[model samples]
Target chain A: MDAIRIDNLTKYYGTARKGIRGIEQVSLTVAQGEFCGFIGPNGAGKSTTIRTLLGLIRPTEGSAQVLGLDIGKDREEILARTGYLPSEAMFYPGMRVRDVLKLSADLRKKDCRREAATLCERLQLDVSRKVEELSFGNRKKAAIICALQHEPELLILDEPTSGLDPLMQRAFFEILRERNKAGVTIFLSSHVLSEVQRNCTRAAVIREGRIVACDSVEALSRTSAKRVVIHGRVDLGLLSGVRDLEETQESCSFLYSGGMKELLAVLAEGEVHDLSVSEPDLEEIFLHFYSRKQ
Target chain B: MTLIKHELRQGRISLVVWTGAIAVLLVICLLVFPEMKGEMKAISHLFGAMGSFAAAFGMDRLNFGTLTGFYAIECGNVIGLGGAFFASLIGISALAKEERDGTAEFLLTHPVSRAHVVTEKLAAVMLQVIVMNLIVLVVSLLSICAIGETVPWKELLLMHSACFLLQIELAAVCFGMSAFLRRGGFGIALGLTTVLYFLNLIANMSEKVKFFKYITPFGYCEGVDVIMNGGLDIRSIATGMLFAVLGIVAAYKMYCGKDIR
Candidate 1:
C-alpha cells in the first residue's frame, strides 16, 4: 500500500476571486519505505502539501490518505504513526531539550527516552540547556530528535537542514538514511537541489502551486537537458535542438538536448577561448520546466 | 495529559504571581476590618450620603458594620477584579500563544487531535483559575481567624463561589476569543473584562440599565448582591453558565477548523 496518496488536493486561502493559491489540484503518491523528495522554491506549496497531508490545514477540495488512513478522518491515528519536523522549529521557552522530548514521548505514549538521549548525543545537543538558550542549530537538532525518537513509520521533514552547519547537516542526513534503511518512509521537502539529489531516490518538482514533474532521481538526471556555455565568436545558427538560447558579444549559452558529438564538432569549428558542458542541476532543470511555457 | 502538564508548567509563574498578589491584597483588606469595626456606623452614614457613588459599587445594599459585610465590600472587589484579570490573561493567551510564539507547529503535529489540544488547554486554564481561587479562599479564612472574627462559613462560601463562577465565565469568553487571534489578545481580554465589569456597574447605578446585568457575568456574582441575598442567584448563575458553555463550544468549533499558518 502507498504510504501517502493525495487525490486532486487543493487549498486556497481567503475567497476564490482574491484568494492565494496554497496548492492547486496537487496529486502524488509515495509508496511504503520510499524516500521521496519534494522540491520547490519558497511559497511553491511544498509545505502546504505536507501540512495538508498532516491534517494541519484542511483542503479546500479533494482529499488525502496517509498510511492508508484518511487524512481528515484518521488524522490522530496517522499522526501517531508519523513524525514531522517543520521548516522553522520552535519550542516553548524555559523548557529544557529533555523536557521537550519527554513531552513528545508522553503524547505519543511511547518510551523514547533511550532513543532521545542517543539522538541528542549523536547530534551533539545539550539536553540540559533551556530551549530559549539553545542556538538555532541546536534547537533544530532538538526538533530532529523529537521527530525521530518515537520510531514513527513515516517522517515528514520540511526544510530540515536550513539552520544546520555542514557537519550537523551531514550527521542529520546520515541519521535519516539510517532510519530509511530501517523501513521508515521519508518525505523531505527542500529548496536545495543538491541535498535532495544526494538523499532522495525519487523527487517531485513543484512550481507555482503545481507539481510539474515527478520521477526517479536516475531517470530525472538521465533525461535532464545539459547546459552548454561557449566563449569566442560562434555562428548563431550552428546548433539545433537547443532551448532557452541566449547570446552575448563574447559568449553564448543554451540548454542542449541534441547529440553531444555533433555539439562538440560544432564547438571545435570555432576558436574556443573557453568551453564548459555539465549536467544541469535540479534548479536549472526546474527553471527549464518553468520557462517552457514562455 | 502531557499537554496539560506542559501548560501548567509554562503558566506556573503567572499563576504564582496572580495568586500571590490577590492573596496579599485580601489579607490587607481583612487586617483593616478590625479598625473600621468601631466606626462602622459613621462610615455607613458617610457612604449613604455618597448616593450614586455608593450605588455604583453596590455599597448601598451591603451592611458595613458586620465583619462579613466589610469583607464582602472591601476584599470582594480585589478578588473579583484580580481573578477576572488573571482568568482573562490565561484564556486570551491559551491558544494564541502557540501561534504567536510559533510553537503551534510543534505542539499540533503530535499524536493529538485539534479538539484534544483545545480541551487540554481549557482544562489547564480552568485548573489555574481554580488554584488561584482556592488560594484566595484559604488566605481569607486565615485572615478572618487572625482577626478574631467568627467565621460566617455559609456567606463566605457563597461569595467565593460566586467569584469563582465569574472568573470561569470570563475565562471561557476570552478562551473563545483566543482561537480567532493570531497575535496575543492581552489588550482585548483586559478591555473586555473591564467593559463587562462597567456594564455591571452601570446596571447597579441606574434602573434604566438594569437589563445589562443579565448580560454581564459580574452582575451574577457582585459581592454585595451575594451578601445581601445570602446566596447565589440561581437564574443569573444558570445564564452565566450558558454563556460560558456557548463560548467554549464556539472556541472548539473555530479552532478545530482553523488553518494554523
Candidate 2:
C-alpha cells in the first residue's frame, strides 16, 4: 500500500477572482517503507503539499489519501498513524518539553513514554526546561521527539533540520534512517539539497507549485548537466545546452549538457591554458529546474 | 480529555487571578456592610436623590438599609462585571491563542479532530466558569454568615445563579468570536463586555430603550430585579440563552472550517 497518494491536489489562498495559487495539479505517491525527499525552494508548495495531506488546509481542487484513507474523510484516522513535524517548533509557552511530548502521546492515546525518553536522551534534549526557556535548537529537538515517540507508521517532516546544529542534524537523520529501516515510510521536505541527496533514495523536485521531476537521487544527479571550467577566456553561449555561464578574466565556467566534442570544439577556439569538467551538484540542478517555465 | 486538561492547565493562572480578585472584593464589601448598616437609611435616601445614576445600577428598586439590597447592588455588580470579564477573557483566548502562538500547526495535525478540539476547549471554559462562580459563591455565603446577617438564601442563590448564567452567555459569545480571531482579541472582548454592561445600564435608566434589556445578559441578571420580582426574568433569560446558543454554534462551524495557517 502507498503511504501517501496525492491526485491533482490544488490550493488557492483567497477567492477565485483574487486568489494566489498555493499548489496546482500536484500528483505523487510514496510507497510504504520508502524514504522520499520533497525538494523545493521557499514557498514552492513543499509545506503546502504536506499540510494538505495532513488535512490542516482544505484543497481547492482534487483529493488525496494517506495510508489509503481519504484525506477529507479519514483525517483523524490518518493522523493516528502519521507523524508530522511542522517547519516551526512551537508549543504552549509554560509547558515543559516532557509535558509537550506527553500531550502528543496522550492525544494519540498511546503509551510513548519509553520511546519519548529514548528519543530525548538520544537528542540530548532537556525535558525539564520550559518550552519558552529552551533554545531554538533544543525546541526543535523537543518537536522531533514528539513526532517520533508514537512509533507512527508514516513520518512527514518539513524543513526539520533548519535550526539543528550539524551534530544534531546527523543524529536526527540517523534516527530517521533507523525508522525507515524498521519499515516506516518517511517524507522529508527541505530546500537543503545536499541533505536530501545524501539521505533520500528518491526525490521529487517541486517548483512554483508543481512537481517538475521525480526520480531516484542518483538518476536526478545524472540527468543534471556537467560543470565545465576553461582556464582561457571563452564565449560558450553559442554551444548548445550550456547554462549559467560565468566568465572571469582568466577563465569561464558553465553547466554543459551537450556532446563532449561540441564542448571541446568551443574550448579549442580559445587560447586554452587549463580545463576541468566535474559533475554538477544537486543545488545547480534545482536552480536549473527553478529557472525553467515548467 | 487530554485537550481539556491542557486547556485548563493553560488557563489556570487566569482563573485563579480572576476568581481571587472578584471574591476578595466581594468579601471586603460584605464585611463593611455591617458597619455601614446604621447609616444605611440615610445613605439610601442620598442615593435615591442621585436620580438616574441610582436607577442605572438598580439602587432605585432595592432598600440599601437591608443586607439583601446592599448585597444585591454592591456584590452583584462585582460578580456581574468581573465574572463577565473573566469568562470573556477565557472564551476569547480559548481558540485564537493556538493560532497566535503558532501552535495550531502543531496541534491540528494530531489525531484529534477539530470537533474534539472545539468541544474539549468549550468544556474547559465552562469548567472554569463554573469553578470560579462556585468559589465566589462559597465565599459570599461564608461572609454573609460571618457578618451575622440573614443569609437571604433565595435572593443570594438567585443572584449567584443569574450571574453564572450571564457569564455563560458572555463566554459563549466571546468563544464564537475567538474562532475568527488569529491574534489578540483583548480589546474586542473588553469593549464587548463594557458595551453589554452599559447597554444594561441604559436599559435600566430609560423606558425609551427598554428593549436593550433583551440584547444584554445583564438585563436578565439584575440584582434589584431579582430582589423585587423574587425570580429571574424569564424573557430576558430566554433571549440571553438564545444568543449563547447561537454563539456556540457559530464557533464550532467557523473553527471546523477555518484554515490553520
Candidate 3:
C-alpha cells in the first residue's frame, strides 16, 4: 500500500492570484518505505506541497491520504505517526532544547528521551542551552533532533539539511538511509541534486506548482543525456544519426538511451584525441532538459 | 491543562510584575487615605480624580470618596487594567505566538486539533487571571487589616467580586479578536482592549450610545452601576460572558480550517 497518496492537490491564497498559487494540482504518491526527493527551485510550491501533506494547510481542492486515512479529516491520527521538519526552524524562545523535545514527545504520547539525546549528539547540539540563545544553525539542529526523536513511521522534511556543515550533512544522510532501510518512508525536499542523486532512489522535479518530471535518477539521466567530452577536436556534422546529439562550441554531449552499439560505431570513426565518455549527473541532465524549453 | 501551565510559565513574570505594582500602590493608598480623614472636600476631589483614572483604566463602577469607595476604585482600576492587558497578551498571542515563533507547523503537525489547542491556551489565560486576582485579593485583605479602617465589608466584597467575571469576559473578547484580526494575535488583542474601552467611555458620557455597551466587554467590566447598587448585575455579566463564549467558538471555527504560513 502507498504510505502517502496525494491526488490533484491544490491550495491557493487570496482570491487575487487565481492564476498562480504556491502549489496547484500537484499530485504524487510514494509507496511504503520508499525514499523520495521532491526537487524544486525556491517558491516552486515545494514547501507548500509538504505543508498540505502534513495537514498544516487546507487544500483548496483535492485531498491527501496517509496510511489509508484522509489527512484533512483525520489529522491527529495521521500526524501521530509522522515526523516533520519545516523549511524554517521555530520553537518557544524561553524553552531549553531538552524541554522542547520533551514537549513534542509529550504531545505525541511518545517517550523519546534516549533517541533525542542520541540525535543531539549526532547533530552536535547541546540541548542544555535555551533555544533563544542558540545560533541559527544550532536552532535548526534542535528542530531536526525533535523531528527524528520519535522514530516516526513517515518523515516529511523540507529543506532539511540547509544549515548543516559538510560533515554533519553526510551523517544526516547516513541516518536517513539507515532509517529508510528500517522501513521508514522519507519525503525530502532540497535544491542540492548531488545529495538527492546519492540518497534518493526516485525523485520528482517540481516547477511552477506542478511535477514536471518523476523517475529514478538513472532513468532520468539516461532519458536526457550522457557526456563524452573530447578535450581535442571532433567532427560535429558527422555526429548526426547518433540519436542523442548535443554539441557546444567547445564540447559534444549525447544521451546513451540508444545503447553502446551506436557509441562504439561513433568511436571507431573518431580521431580519438583524449576521448572520455562518462555518465551525466542528474543536475546536468535536468538542466539540459529544462534549458531547452526556455 | 498542560497547555495552560505552559502559558502560565511564559506569562508568570508579567502577572507578577503587574500584581506587585498593584500591591505596592494599594498599600500606599491605604496609608495616605486615612491621613486625610479630617479634610473631606480636598480628599474628595483627589479621590474623584483617582476614580476617573480608574474608569479610564477600566474600574469605572466604584466611587473614590469613602473607604468602601476607595476599595471599589482601587479594585476597578488595578484589576481592570491588569485583566485587559492580560487578556490582550494571552488571547491574541495564544495562536499568533506559534506562528511568530515558527512553531505553528510543528505544533499542528502533532496529533492535536486546533480546537483543542485554542481551548487549552484560553484555559491557561483564564487560569492566570484567576491566580493573579486571587493574589491581589489576599494582599488587599492584609492591607485592609493593617490600615485599621472600619468599613462596610459586604459592599466592598460585592464591588470587587464583579471583577472576576469582568476579567474573564474581557480576556475572551481579546481572544475572539485575535482570530478576526489580520495583523497578528497581540495586535488584535490590544486593539480590541483599547477600542472597546473608548466605546464604553463614549457610551457612559451620553445617552445616545448606551446600547453600544451591550456589544463591548468594557461596558460591563467597568460599569459603576453594578458597584454603586451593592450587588452584581447578572444582565451585563451574562452579556459579556455570551460574547466570551462566542469569541472562543469563533476562533476555533475560523482557525480549524485556516491555512498556516
TM-score of each: 0.95, 0.97, 0.88
Name the best candidate (by DockQ): 2
Error of 2 at B105 (Å): 1.5
- By the DockQ metric, which is better: model 1 or model 2? 2
Q: Report model 1's TM-score to 2 decimal places.
A: 0.95
What C-alpha lDDT do the candidate models reach, one value each?
A: 0.90, 0.92, 0.75
Q: Which stretches of candidate 3 lie over 4 Å from their true place?
A: A16-19, A228-278, B41-63, B180-185
Worst 10 residues of 2 chain A by lDDT: A285-294
Give me the TM-scores for chain A across all models, comma-separated. Answer: 0.89, 0.95, 0.84
Tell me the deviation in Å of residue A117 in model 3.
Answer: 2.0
Q: Model 3, residue A184: displacement in angstroms?
A: 1.0
Candidate 2 DockQ, CA atoms: 0.88
- Mind giving the per-residue lDDT tens digits that candidate 3 earns over B62-124? 445567666655555566666677756767766766766677877888888888888888888
Off by over 4 Å in 1: A16-18, A235-250, A257-278
Model 3 score (lDDT): 0.75
Cα misplacement distance, residue A144 of candidate 1 (Å)? 0.4
- The positional error of residue A30 in candidate 3, measured at the CA in angstroms, is 0.8
